[model samples]
Target: MKPSEEKPAIIALPKARRHTYYFLNYADEFKSVYLDTEIDMSEVKRRRDKLKLSGHRISYIVFLIEAISRVIRLYPEANSSVKHGMIPQMAVYHRIAAKFTLDKTMDGRRFVMSGIIPDSDQMPLEGMQKMIEYYRDTEADEITEFANVRKLQSMPLWLGRWIYRLAMGNLSRRAKLQGTFTITSLGHRPIQAFYPIISNTLCFGVGAIEDKPVVMAGQIAIRPMMKLSLAFDHRAIDGALAADILTEVKKVLEFASESDEASTQGEEVTPVGAST
Candidate 1:
């Protein structure tokens, strides 16, 4: 083999990864807002156990997707993307699109996959679960992010960086290519704290759920709780907006079991549990 063949070859990168590669590198003014909140899992665990007993199953990620989607519906600003600039003029998305992370092992190292769920606000829980499971199992050619990433890795790093910067310079294309927000779940890991890399206006991570003691009804109780961390672009999002979105998201998760029914019947249930 030739000496050069033994080293890495130059690659031609596709649009999405190149854009991501550049934005992450060049956007030094981008701000991140980190938050920690917990969700009560009493209802979710019950529903999950019941489904499993009946040979039906749904992952918590389904509920997670719905919760965030609903929050963005009421607060579209949370889903806005940068139109352009080191300082960006924001473009709002009327519909919510979620970007999720997945992993596959290759040669004993991690090969990351991107999962995009569009219109999660309207997708039923069952459908969301099925879609996630399908993507997790297959390396489908249609997964544009992963497909582009594979190509990006084949190129020399320095070449890839410049190509990324050039490709991402187009504001019109960038907003459409990248998801409005990102979600990463740490359920499979034992981690209790989750902080994510923010490329959009906002990104959040679902930390592990575990049983813990809490005071409820003025008495001690043990409950299952999960920690959530959210990071926001301070340039585009203010503290007030971020706080309200967090409040909205917390409400959706704690009462996730009743939210759909309540929306349909137009009657709100008395909220239970705490998140702080």
Candidate 2:
């Protein structure tokens, strides 16, 4: 057969993924600064194992969210987003809201969506995990947010673009709709490091955890390590502040112990949307 005659088949883009194009197009408005660091997950693994043995299992993403949320609370500048105009303005949030994406299957096709955990700094580890589990396990059609995403996908491309921009134009609503920052992970695969785009001021990229050689006490030893990458809009955040936040998150993750878990469990705070 002639090479020209043996062409590969092509498929149309699914409506479910239509929003990603809008998101990427919108992300182009910001100039993002990227950084990556390796985190030693040895202690965190040990703590998680202990918790799991006690029937209080916590997911790695939830744990990282809790830690990073606290760090975000410490750095006010880190919890802000920029609104561009004739002169740009920064919208600082009083609460730390963590946004994480989920891969959902709808109508036999897979699509990605996100969920927000408001006041994440105040939420306990178990509570955050519960919300994440809900997002992961629930049917996409059943959840109001995911349902809205479907509606957007079903709209014409121009209409969807207008609606998305309208919703994202207001910083306050954008924070509530999205979050102060975003966390995306490819940890299920063997990928070690990658950079992500930013909608808000910051976006965190998480890579898989694997055994790697590291120096400890002046000796090389194998340790369970994960790659954490941060992408920040330089217009809203400077490199110094971003580095500080990344370092703080790394410290919170690497030095985490059973005591840290105990402290969070002892905090008297309601879950994200619990009635008062």
Name the top lDDT candidate.
2
Query: Which clashing pairs does model 2 show?
Result: none
Model 1 accuracy (lDDT, Cα): 0.70
Instruction: Tell me model 2's lDDT, rounded to 2 decimals.
Output: 0.84
Candidate 2 lDDT, 45-142, residue by residue in tens: 98889889988878899888987887776677778888877877779989888999989887788888899988888788888888999999999888
Models 1 onward score TM values of: 0.79, 0.90
Can you write out model 1's per-residue Cα lDDT over 153-244, one digit (the tens) per residue?
Answer: 55676877776556556644545445688888878899988988776788888889999998999998999989888888887789878877
Model 1 worst lDDT window (10 residues): 262-271
